[model samples]
Target: MDISTVEDALVTDAKAHLIQPWPTSGQIGAEARSGLMDGDGIYVTDMEGRRLIDGPAGMWCTNVGHRCEPIARTLYDQAMALSYSSPWYTMSEPSVRLSKRLAGHAPGDLEHVFYTTGGSSAVETALRFMQFSNNVTGRAEKKLIIARQGAYHGSTYLSASLNGRPRDHDWMDSASDLVVKLTCPNPFRRPSDMTEPEFCDFLIGELRDVIETRGAENIGAFVAEPIMASGGVIVPPQAYLKRMRALCQENDILFIADEVVTAFGRLGHVFASKEVFDIEPDIITFAKGVTSGYFPLGGAMISSKLLERLRSSNHSDAMFAHGLTYSSHPIGCAVALTNLDLLEQGLLAHAQEIAPYFQSQLKTLEDLPLVGEVRGLGLMACVECVADRKSNNPLALDLEVGKRIDAHCQRLGLLVRPLIHMCVMSPPLTITRPQIDDLVSILRQGIKLTMDELVREGLWRG
Candidate 1:
């Protein structure tokens, strides 16, 4: 690296390469980091000399932990053997094998793979595939994607548009019209505070209303996360997805599962739908844990029915009409293969068995008056903060409650994502009991310090 003018916290000129949904206040946090990464056992060290526990698993990926030698060696060897080999004109062994391997673990008959460079691109592929399948199967009228509110799909224009998250489209004057946004099966913010089944019915009713308004013939597919992540780690109502599956089947619409945040053992299942949730999707989207963030690889796993339509299509020359240059890149596929082996070797089960212990440790936070709710599955979890114990009114984001908590955690050698009033954690799967304990202890101390700072600033009184 070259010499540059350095600021107190973040780089003055060098910009962070990642998109921030909620950027930290004026250069004092994750925004500031040098390019150097030194020795790491569980946590990594940036050149700036801050050692963070990496609670969010590097944005809920990296399930295998940092610096796994197997993944590194495999990627290096694959690169030396062959890296890019014209995926459009020809397929390599790594790509083919990875597809087969992915198909084996995917739910239902999702036996075919269409690769992409990352998760959002995978969502783009799915939407295009849905439209293509509809047209190929003689249903050109079906062109709408029924999406749920507060759901997150991806950042690409079409993918974000298809996602019903309001914040994603705040600045856009003309909203995307192709998506028919519907209420999600969320228990926390239910319209009537009804039962879970009733919630499903209400959500389904919204979908039906959209179909009626747009005409059932105009709906192409319904896309959702098996268990919502990012929006909130919501384990769907037991019967929610199964009923939604039936709804899609009856309507002759495609079912797409956005498993970017939930797949690859995050939910204690190789396939969240097959092992944990038990609902089959016609198509599934995957990323994050595919290679455990060792390499960027994402894709769509489609059912046999879609494959048949592709084979029997009237236009062979028409193409599936979408692809990415890095689709099934050899190095990425090789790393993913190695990472999957780790998961299969029982890491996922270990995380599952230990989740209760982590949950038990976190239960102590309930006594904290600032804490609202604690929820998650597997190794991922969240703690929501509210102003009053009886009322669920979240402390506003600008008040910097999340920021104060995060900064305090950083000072205490922990890193976490502060989402609105929530302080979330997704520690690596290899994290031990003691590490979990340290994580909670640091978090508790961080909360106390943050509250003190706030009280001192006259934002609140003790």
Candidate 2:
């Protein structure tokens, strides 16, 4: 049978059996879907054998690239040795070693580790820990979580409630009263008249107001991503994180740094909280690139200070009571250990060297009329489409500008993530300068193609 015939069969089976996440039913089989067959380095091959450069790195997780032999071998060897162990009572060698290694790399005196299955679980664990700590210390009312608009924490019941993205909570029911939201510190989305410094001050002042009104004793934690990845790669001002940390310190609120996307070399570091952002978070939640998308593994790093307090406090006898069956899976830990080695060996340095070039090249897209903004930090970036450059008004949602760009980019031998009216890119850290050039060229053409289509449809003028 021809490859085309095989691809058709697979797509048919997928349409019937697969239920995709975050899309309407009509979008399922509306377009020709590419079934990824394999990945090598920065490229992935579809069922039809088309090799395309992976732009978003499998949801911003594949930092060390694809089909890494060491990672694969580690997974295989660990499975052969010990696949699973009940994390409730028993412990595994790999898990212990990984915890020690991660704690060493983590910021501050965060010396304790609680393993989870993935990013959501890591976040869930952190929030649960905060609640438990508060309850044990006789501060049951201090359970309110403070999350920011445009933040993506996770999808679990408690963690999802902390999500501030509109679409994430529009249809879904959340523990709303339990989570209070602060303004998203997106400089690009800030009011036009406000200067960057003024915008920062405004956001900081708003947090202070929330603390004063809501009462800092009532708030449990303030969760934030150093660079808001899923929220169109919104990078805040340099001093924003430091200032927030101070506020948390002053209020006795636990500061949870959701470094799921920024950690493990995506930002050219093992952990970005202290190394890049210069903040000491009480708890740090991490996942995604921890295993470089090779295995499902995530964890929370607890500060020694907090743990000591919890131990010395009356809640020392209170059971925290939270554990996933796969919390400390040996196979996942083995793969993550190897993944960390790969990052430290060379990929981290490579990412640090090439990130500025990547950001600069993507920024060049701003010259295009359809591009309202091109913003990024390190390997992550986003191109926000706009109907009017002067007003920076976003293009109509019905236009599906990001999807249009994705289609053109796919045709041009590249893959990008479409987030509403924006296209996000965070390719494998191992991507070369030449590959970045190719990626940018395709994006340029894709934007042009999208613009032409919108103009032809009378939906936009460019």
Candidate 3:
């Protein structure tokens, strides 16, 4: 290998060879994203050697922070011991150990685990298991999945179909008929005439109406993220999740809580569905922070009651017929176990302690005229820029406002996750109070700079 040539042409080669996720048509295979060279704690050094606060925490996965020694050591040690294991034929000790640990942390009767490669695979597994269970129990017609607007499940075909973001389906194909999308529960975007409580009522009534019209027997599951992450961190109204869970129970619709971004210490807990919202779901899909982005690992923690029902069914011999080659990779499982250890050993408590400070400091940004609203829960938050404060409309402004803010923030030593006109912040759980102050300060300056730029360009009047 020509080391010098590769090193000199890294960005050029990436432009020529890489197909980055969510690429635009104009630069699908040629976009050169910001190159990160190194990471330590909640900070990452860019290719230019500028250290920046990891504002989005590596897409909301680096819970315990970057370069965590125990997780890194576990990855190396596990690979040295036993790198691969055929999950179908034999399971590794780490996988079994991780399963027991996860089951212990999981809420209610969610005592069984089905490992997957990542969030998409976890969601796909849960849906497939739902279908498989329905088929075995003699209800083949029960296959519809209920999702919500502004929700993001995953990238796999079936999982992607459940994504409610319009752009996700703009140019791509999906099994749209198999999924039903309800209205987004963002109070900021709710109808102008409806109060917050009324908005909540409307959402619940809509779900009830859908169940009645579509028939609960035909609906297999209702999947939701406790707090919508990728959809600009849209946290629903109070008691919304619990009420939805109750509805799912009454209608016999399996509740699949997609905790891909909310689990594993993100919300200061191993799982957020029960602790944060006081509802125990029938199935919970998790990934991301489980291994703190050190290794790709995810799984669906299924209810034991559901498993028992399937076991007692007449066609119990039928197979689920789904799995991944890396279903229970020894290295991934080992890494997850160590990552959990870090969380259990006070990292989770630290997150709980610092989240309030993080949120309050970010809330101060609302004083900026360009900020439409600041909303989120726990360590995840979104700063939405609107065209006008009174109307709170983002459509009238430049759609690339987020990107502009991100460009300014990066120059000021912070990397933001720009989502259209919104900027999402989910720094690593390992971040301290001073680090949170720095993050908010950088973000505030970034927005102010963006506002000035817009004014100079005749884009806005600040």
Candidate 4:
């Protein structure tokens, strides 16, 4: 197994062998690949040895930053002790202990844990549990899932079907009939005639109508992210989540909160379902920050009441018949356990304290002509670019504005996650106020450079 030191050879080999997720083969071949060689707190060094601030926190995970020795040590020690186990029938000490800790941190009576490989698997597990419960209780028709239009559940077949972002299902197939999509509750994108309260009312009314028209008996669950993450950090009205929760309860619909990107201190809390959003979901799916990108791990927390009901009902003998081979992997659980410890020690509090500063600095970007809106909560924020400031009309898709801004940002010593025309930022919770300032400064320059290019290309009149 000889590794290539030559840059061209490395790039060629990668192009030949690696099928990167979420990108086309032509895109990969056309782009120059830069390998990340190392990382420290809040920064990663590329193959060229250029250290840049990690802006998207490695896909909104890395809450505790990179090169965490304790997390690494825990992984190594666990692998040396007991690396793998058949989660189907066997169990490991690390998995058991981690489950107990997660239960303790989870909201309400969500005490039971079903581990998985990552966020997708966690969501899949939750959905399957809903289906299984329905089947066992003789309500097999209650299998429909409701997800919001900007929601990003996961990439697995069932979970991906719940994803409502544009182009998410472009070339892919989804079980669309099984999933229903509601309007994205983005206050920034609400109708012009509606006030905030009126918009919230309209959304709630729409949801109620959908349930009534579709028949709540046919719906098993309504899944949502407290704050839409990968879908441009779309935040709903303050009372939106609570109202939705109440509706679910009234209609016997299971509320599933997808907290993959929100949990573990991204919102300055272990779990934001109840703590930050004031709603207790019957099932909550979490991943990413669980192990702070040190290892792959995720799980679904089940409300104790649901589990008890399933046990006492005739479903007691029915097998859930769903699980990943990597479920409850010792190494992942060990890494997550240590990551939790790090967060509890101080990282969570630090995130809570610095979030205001992060949001405030990014909000200042709205002053830029190309920026349509700057919105976010806690450490997550997005800068939406537009062609016209007054009308908030988006730029042409061919402009690839987000990618252009990201390129400039990379050249200026920062890495950002670009989604279409939106630039997303979810830096590590361990980042300092000074780091926040640096991030905003780079973003400002990047946006300005993009504006200059647009003007030079005669694409914009500004």
Worst 10 residues of 1 by lDDT: 1-10
Q: Provide the global lDDT of candidate 3 against the true structure.
A: 0.93
Report residue 125 deviation for candidate 1 (angstroms). Answer: 0.2
User: Candidate 3, residue 93: CA error in Å?
Assistant: 0.5
Ranking by lDDT: 3, 4, 2, 1
Among all windows of 10 consecutive residues in model 3, the one with the lowest summed lDDT is 1-10
lDDT of each: 0.79, 0.91, 0.93, 0.92
Clashes of 2: 0
lDDT value for model 2: 0.91
How far does residue 4 in candidate 2 sit from its true spot (Å)?
Answer: 2.0
Residue-wise lDDT of candidate 4 within 1-462, one digit each (tens)? Answer: 233465567677777777667777567644446677689999998766678999999999999999989988897898899989999889999999999999999999999899999999999999999999989888999999999999899999999999998688988999999998999999988988999999999999989999999999999999999999988999899799999999999999999999999999999999998889999999999999999988889999999998887888865679988888999999999999999999999999999999999999999998898999999999999999988866778898643899999999998999999888999999999999999999999999999999999999998876
Residue pairs that clash (backbone atoms under 3 angstroms), model 2: none
Show model 4 residue runs off by greater than 4 Å: 1-5, 25-32
- For residues 241-305, write the lDDT of model 2, one tens digit per residue: 99999998999999999999999988889999999999989999999999988888899999999
lDDT of 2 at 145: 92
Cα lDDT for residue 116, model 3? 97
Candidate 3 deviant stretches above 4 angstroms: 1-8, 395-398
**TM-score to true structure, per model:** 0.91, 0.97, 0.98, 0.97
